[model samples]
Target: MAKRSFVWGLGRYLILATAGLLAFVAVVLVALRFVNPPTSAFMVAHQLSADDARVRQNWVALEDISRWMPRAVVASEDQRFLAHWGVDVNAIQAALDEYRSGGGLRGASTITQQTAKNLFLWDGRSLFRKSLEALLAVAIDASWSKQRIMEVYLNIAEFGRGIYGVEAASQAFFGISASQLSPQQAARLAAVLPSPKKMSAADPTPYLWQRVRWIQQQMAPLDGF
Candidate 1:
């Protein structure tokens, strides 16, 4: 009887703990709608790591950043940024089909999803992290505008080892401010995003240059942001 009672008690405590955690997460998500986050999980981890020196990041408002930046990122990362709520269904479907066909895995994460993961979650490909990212993406999409989403993503995205945000990346790679970035420079920065630590925005390889040109080509069609 005592063992059964203890089991029931443990279950009840777990339930309550889960509920409280959910409530706390919900509150934080809602609050982030109005507040700019100071730092992210990735940032904290990078700072704490012994091998990596603390990098630079300066948050510039969307209005302060170059207009080319958002367009460049949209072209390079998520083309349907303005259309999708949070998740891109077509991209997800394409990725699944590719995986089923035994093709190499492709990332289907949208900008909002990336923002959710970068801001609130740890770096990983685990199911639990993905689930939390999806939930947070939905909350962010519902609470924030597309412009705000783009702004936050630009500010928080990791560009290179210890380098974050367009402002920091611009200065680090080109010795310019985010507002002064040219179209080509912006495209190069966007191209390096997939593997910033390995790729160089300052000195692009042939493949990176190819991606930069492609991103630049995509910018015109995606103009008017």
Candidate 2:
């Protein structure tokens, strides 16, 4: 009888502990709705390609992102950034078609989804990851704006070998301040984004040179404001 009574008490404690955990989660979610959480981020290789932007910290606003990085990424990565909430139906469909056809890895993550996964989630690209990315994307959209999302993306994306963020990427590659980077310099940085380790801003590969030109052309068409 004592053993059975002890088991019952243990079960009750477990249930109460579970409830408390759930309540804590609820409280956190609610607090996120009312206040911004201070971001603590990791600097992946590409994004932190240089030493200066190696450290991670909270990224706050659109102006901070725009001042540091080129506007070309907006044109290349997500032209519909301002229009969409968290997902882009057309882009998602195209990515699905390409994935189904086995054309390539993937190319359909919206800025918001990118922000959610890059800043807060893991880096695996799988079905489960995709589903959780969607969930987190929705949550990010509800919790932040397009400007905020883009700001976070630039700060967190792996740009190069131990270098992260526009500030770090610019300084590492061109030996210039991010705000001082010309459009061409910015384009070179953007071009290497897919494979920063292989590419170089100090001396771009032939492939990256061509891509940089494309990025430059795209930048002319962007309405970044």
Candidate 3:
């Protein structure tokens, strides 16, 4: 009888703990909808790491950034950014189909999902982390606007080793503000996003240039969002 009672009590405690955690997360998400985050989980990780170089990031409003910049990233990273809630089911299905057809595995993470990962999670492919990321993405999408998601993503995304955000990246690579970025320059920045550590936006490789051209071509339809 004592064991049964203890089990019941433990179950109730667990349920209450889960509910409290969820409520806390919801409140934070809602608060961040209006308040610009000073730093992100990834940025904090970089600051805490033993790396000698300092992390660079400068927050800019969506309007402060060049229109071409957002369109370039939308074209390169998530073409369906305006449509999806958080997850892109069609992209995931296409990726899975390609995998089934003996193609290399590809990621179909949406902009919101990437933002969620950068804001609250670490680098990993564990199932638990991915699941949590999806939930966070949904919460963020529900709480924030499309423009807000883009603003946070552009600000927090790593553009190079120890360099973050379009503002810092523009200064580091092109000696200009993000607002002054030309279409070609914005495309170059978007090109390095896939492997920021390995790829240099300051010194574009042949493959990087190829990607830049592709992104530029894709940017046409987005019409400088």
RMSD of each: 1.7, 5.2, 1.1
Winning candidate number (lDDT): 3
lDDT of 3 by residue, 155-199 (tens): 999999888899999999999999999999999999998789899
Candidate 1 or 2, higher TM-score?
1
Each prediction's whole-model lDDT (CA):
0.91, 0.68, 0.91
For candidate 2, write residues 1-225 as lDDT tens digits: 999999999999999998997577457545655554454234443244445554533333446444425377766577788887788889989887988897885768887777767665666778898887787787677666566666667766657766667777766777765667777877777777767668777888788788888877777867755
Q: Candidate 3: give the clashing pairs.
A: none
The 10-residue segment of model 1 with minimum total lDDT is: 46-55
- Candidate 1: where are CA atoms >4 Å away? 1-7
How does model 3 fare in lDDT?
0.91
- Which candidate model has the greater TM-score, 1 or 3? 3
Once superposed on the true structure, which residue ranges of model 2 sit more than 4 Å away at CA?
Answer: 1-41, 44-70, 99-102
TM-score for each candidate, following the candidate numbering = 0.93, 0.73, 0.97
